[model samples]
Target: MSALGAVQPAEAAGGTRAERGDRESLFRPLSAEDGEQLPAEIESLCMNCFQNGVTRLLLTRIPFFKEIIVSSFSCDSCCWSNTEIQSAGRVQEQGVRYRLAVTSRQDMDRQVVKTDCATATIPELDFEIPPFTQRGVLTTVEGIIDRAIAGLEQDQPIRRATDEGVAQKIEEFIGRLRQLKEAQSPFTLVIDDPSGNSFVENPRAPQRDDALVVTRYRRSPQQAAALGLQGEELEEPAEPAEDLHNEVLQFNTNCPECNAPAHTNMKLVQIPHFKEVIIMATNCESCGHRTNEVKSGGAIEPQGTRITLRITDPSDMTRDVLKSETCSVEIPELEFELGMGALGGKFTTLEGLLKDVRDLVERNPFTLGDSSAPDRTQKLQEFIGKLQEIIEGQRTAHFVMDDPAGNSYLQNVFAPEQDPEMQVQHYERTFQQNEDLGLNDMKTEGYEEETGSR
Candidate 1:
């Protein structure tokens, strides 16, 4: 520090040259520090951070790094020999670090700007690399093509010639192949294209030797001959003869001779008081012989007659007698009345008249007179007594004297006993007779008569 002593005399008069040197040494550059230093690990970490940060900055400015390498080449004396010396000099001048840095920064700025624009318009390049223009790119492409060809040969032959035309031809061929495959085994294989369209194709078609052809069933020649028909001819069946006598026979006749035709005469015959009858007589016109073929009998008897009687209700004088012409009963001293509408005239009958009168009396017993009324009861009793005497006289003539007509009349009178009015009249008459004849007198008379007769 002899040089220090000579130079620092003006400012370091207060300290020795050595002290000043020590103080100055404390303010020296960090690189001059010996023991006061960062650790090697920390230095290495700092260096890495700086380097990575710089790399990130360069990468951020140069967006082309994200894109696939489209081209790469180097200019050298050997490669650009035709260039003049002046251009060479300019290129050499551009090789300086400052120049390179400036040029590289400008390129990075341009790439970042273009990358922003390209990213939005690069949809076609979504899964594809850029077109290669580098020197060795052709060799890479050739290798890729070879690999593709090898894969296709190993798998299956290319059905179509070129990639662009392959899709359309494959589609048409696949359509036909699918039909064939479906006809054979009902199985199908579908292939899908990158554009999300799909088609079915039959790979099995190439393996098959023959195609299938659909056909309709046909009879064999031998079968046709066995069935008594020509192999190629079809015949219609003959119609059957019409039958004239299939229905049921309304009338039957016997032909006198084998060749003689049958004839029948039908007639409508009516018997008095009987239903009309249909008679069919079959005759052989040639032989003049006849026989009864059909005779439809009727339910009505030819000699029978129908008589009806009607008794009107006492309360309804306008009510006519109910008549039934279907019954057979003859009554004497009765009038014949014609019925209205379709009903024919009917003659009165004894049983029908009696039954009707009995029904009428039974239905209206009060019309005869009420036995419970004092005056009417006496009158009814007197009338019933007279009627009893008349009935007894008829019965005496019939049962005791054997008078046939009287017996019949007595039977008719007694038959009315079934009627309620007639029964009450008989009871009242008997009661009155018993009252008129004293029980003792009747007893004495009966005793005297018995004694005299004995």
Candidate 2:
């Protein structure tokens, strides 16, 4: 039998009403333009338990989301009923995430959220909420917290491992959480999803509020694994993923510099501690020029990371580095700064990257030998000498990487931070950067840069 009744246009919803004593209500649709002109009927069996039911998928339109299809299904043979959504258009240019601060009760009902591939967390309490492949949520701030409560209540690992005392403390914590919900106390809710499928409500009307923080980032390898993007093939013997990695994919595209067709090389590499990443290299045989790029195979980091290495000896030159395309590399001694797209991202040692930088400067038409600007040429020559010395362990230098997307890394198998020579700091992206990244509705007027100590 059909789980949904009939396809009809959505009208004004009698919005969820709540008394102080009642539980928070579900989100109410506020005057949709038109919804479900036609509903698609399909066969339905619960992917979970193999229960049978007929499904009805209705098409609708959201404000910023454009086309959306909401699917409703209920299994008659089992207790499985769900309403999920599939957006036809995308809102984020990259992996999207959100941080909503719940300070008032009204903020809860003014938003919509999705957690399909998200790892929601409230760091203050060390609570992590995993999306169980359920539909994205269209609810308020209170609803977000309630979902976290539900996950904690049903957490099997904690329940199985904890004794009565620990279990009691957990229950007490949950009670405090409920109290906070009712009290509308302030708490930060972070949703990190690399799929770019999640959404936090924003009405582009009169000025929007700043209680919620929205971000788009490049995912790391480890974060991508949480979304089941990698490591799944390792379980069952799979030749496809392995074979594809070994076989280099090539393309025939015209070079940006030369009119001649360029041969492009692309292959996947699994970084030891990080996730699998694809390296793309393009070479123009006509002009004898080459270009390369590295992309993180995981979910983008929520915050940006800055890595600094003091090269005291040549051995430091061998330290592995993963520089993302969005990363910026700088050498203070040379007064040289290369922004994103300098060489694109690559997995190389510190020495190798520096070599590429010097080579790039050397080849630049403006920076070539004995320039019209003699003083500038002298500085470049001295910088090159110092770089060579550092490579040969004759002089020391400092290497700094500032990445707003936080995908770049300087590999330190040991605790580099403890050595006092290496430093890793994660800072909140500046107001200008957030604007540049298309993170609208941000207000960082008096915002001080907060540094995260590694």
Q: Write the per-residue lDDT of candidate 2 for residues 137-157, one digit (tens) a residue.
A: 556667776866776688645
Task: For each candidate in the order shown, give its overall lDDT on alpha carbons.
Answer: 0.25, 0.64
* Predicted model with the maximum TM-score: 2
What does candidate 1's lDDT look like per residue over 103-217, in tens digits? 1111222111111001111121121112111111111112322322333344233444446466565455444433332333232111111111111111111111121111112
After best superposition, candidate 2 residue 199: deviation in angstroms?
1.1
What ranges in model 2 sit over 4 Å off?
1-38, 47-51, 77-79, 89-93, 131-135, 154-162, 203-208, 223-454
Off by over 4 Å in 1: 1-259, 297-454
